[model samples]
Target: MTLQPTLPARVEKDRTTPPRSGPSRRRDSRYEALTGYLFVAPAVVLFLVMGLYTVGYGFTLSFAKWNGFAPNWEWVGLDNYKDLLWRDPVYAPRVRHAAANTIWVMVAAPVLTVVVSFPLAVLLNQVKRFQGVLRSVYFLPYVTSGVAVFFAWQYILQPDGAINSLLSGLGLGSLQQPQGWLGNPSTAMPTMIMITVWGHVPVAMLLYLTGLQGIDRSILEASELDGAGWWRTNMSVVWPLVRPITAIVLLLNLREALQGFQTFLVMTNGGPGDHTNVLGLEAYRLAFLKNLSPTLGLASALGWLLFAAALVLALINLRALRSKT
Candidate 1:
């Protein structure tokens, strides 16, 4: 929520309460808020110390020249950021490539996840027997460790792996040699998106189930009595009330999708002509891989840039949703 210039009331209570006690209540409330802050003082202090150190140190470093090693450096105010934003050859292309890939995956994967999960969630909600088992089956992929899934996918997507073997049995020639799923640049990102959606479906399913169940049972029965079909009920009733949850899902999905990394790391490693590079990879490369020296500056700039992107996108999505409502 956007804060107004003046702080809004922290709490809303009985406005109709007698005026006689108003002065006393305000004094009491002030003490309560003060005590609450005192109770959380240690946490607040710890958070500020670490957060300020990291952000401030990075911002200061961005204006200097240094490798990833010792802090021995000289101020080069805004040079690195300029290079990254406007001049640097490798940096510009890397950011652009990463942004493109991130946009593509973020756009497609969440929509796919939500679309596929809705019917599954609706069906699960209607089930009476082994409902928990059915949900677990759908959600198993989400709980499986990335390392295990990566290895399993690697084998399944290999040329002579299970997928190709099955394809061959059906007279579909073995996948063109060398690489399988992550082999081709064109397909690597798409495959990652598909795998991501497969594992990520549960979150959307959970959201939809919550929304569906939140609908008043009487309202549903009334709609049914009016002869509304499943599709009609879902579209006109469930979706309207679930708008906030939809926004929540999209916000989370966008973040997860844009920042997805493990799959690319284990599967593609930003290979096949750097097709899978994204903002997350850019941060990794700047901080860890291509360090000229004292990489604090570059890493900090990239971090701030990512923060800005996230903030701007979140606000835009929020505003769009609010306008629709």
Candidate 2:
């Protein structure tokens, strides 16, 4: 090598020095961090104001007696909770009946909805044409106003309504006979359960459809190549893959069933008796609708009780379902 050109000492020193990201780069990084914080600030403020503040206030209110209009709050300590839980005859009965009805709906609605939705989702996934239209039709109830949907179903389930008429036309004359589906205490809860299942199926189906789309086509093909039939492949391969989605669907359904109020309010008003009463409706009645003893404190306490139950149930459900997976 022609004697390597003698490198200038200044050039060599320059080459050896690491580049400094001086004050400007640091300033730019600080600017980026500030922008990120600015972007998140509104959401943080909203949660603090609307979510945390309201929850805190509600918790505090639960221990005090205040008719929402009262200028002063009277501390009752655990009296409100005790009354709802055991002491007050009127409040306790309502709570027990409502809690039982709520449990029934919570158990039945999710099971029935999943039973119906899974097959519909499978069929929809197989359809190659007009799939979007079909999906929209199925999903319409989910996007519709809940009050409107309940009103529509209220009409359909009436004694002389479309369901009865259809049953009559199908020669199920005994079943079509006047039954007062929403008015009769014996039939009201079951009718509500059916409507709840129908309303919830579309959402569960949509979730299942998404899960189905994410399944590996190659695995399905390999299952078929291995002489696995449709039912077998679905039961063995597809079901396992979608277990997480099932868990989500179950949690959502349970939450909705537990907190359901509007449908009962509109359709049956909890009843010919407290037949369709639920904890959410009971809380509302205690807080706002009772002509006698409108106890906001008790209502708040009941609300917190329901919240605790929901939280515990949700955790149990997640644990049970996830552990299976």
Candidate 3:
């Protein structure tokens, strides 16, 4: 009985339904965009004021000679850059030494970190009991206070420190360093490299562990079924799958090595005759530690040079990764 009017009622309802207005939709989109801009405005303003402005100011300052309290910045043109290159004899050798040490750290630290951390990650991944506890333990040093850790390490590497004590107890007293690991020119750089590697291992391990967990169990099982041993499977199959993670770890390690000087500063202070000097420490010394004769211009120039080197190396890394892909 109701079917008699159903078709007419449906048609009427359809005709009466309001069409979506283009202006309304456009307004809604604009509103959303405005809201997004408002939310991000604070961050953008802060970056421009704090980061970009300071960077630009530093670049300008790099072209001028300025003691920290000078009434006016003395225009020096490219003199600061030239000084770092070869012009200033005192500055030139220090820069060269720091540059060499920086390069060594950049290359050695990342490689050692990767070599040490990946295996630890694999082992940790296989752990079934107290996995969380073990992971926390490994990561603890990374989260600990850097100054405290550096001091602890400094104590540990001292002449009569625990390491030498242990060496003596093991009847390897001949191998012990009486000058302390950090004080000896021969051992200082290597010891610093090892400490850098140690500091980075936890991060790399965590990354690898996450990557390993994300891998398909079926692929692993199939590899085992195909008579592949653990090492073989991991090296051949697992490593390839975890290349992305490896890249991240390598980049982070490289950045840290290139930019970090805190550990060396705290532990060695570029001592043993500049054996552990790095670019970052040199820059810091130039900028702040010069007392009344602050070479802020030279420090800024060095900072820019360091930035350029880091950019080049990072670009190379990215290019290599892309080509692999």
For model 2 the TM-score comes to: 0.88
lDDT per residue (tens digit) for residues 1-325 in model 1: 9976986868878779566488888999999999999999998898889998867887787788677666478788887788777788867777777888989888998788878888788888899999889888887888889889988997898767887777777886755434676787767888888887887898788888878887789988888999999999988877778778777878888888666677777777787788887777777777887646555567667777777877887999989887988
| lDDT for each residue of candidate 2 in 51-83, tens digit (9 for 90 to 100) | 999999999999998888768899999988988
For residues 1-75, could you state the per-residue lDDT of candidate 3 as single tens digits?
455544543434455658669998899999999999999999999999999999999999999888889899999
Error of 3 at 39 (Å): 3.0
Give candidate 1's error at residue 296 in angstroms.
3.9
Please name the candidate that would achieve the greatest TM-score relative to the true structure: 3
Residue 12, candidate 1: how far off, in angstroms?
Answer: 43
Between the candidate structures 1 and 3, which one is better when assessed by TM-score? 3
lDDT of each: 0.80, 0.88, 0.93
Candidate 3 has its poorest 10 consecutive residues by lDDT at: 4-13
TM-score of each: 0.82, 0.88, 0.91
Sorted by lDDT, highest first, which candidate order results? 3, 2, 1
State in Å the error of residue 153, model 1.
Answer: 1.7
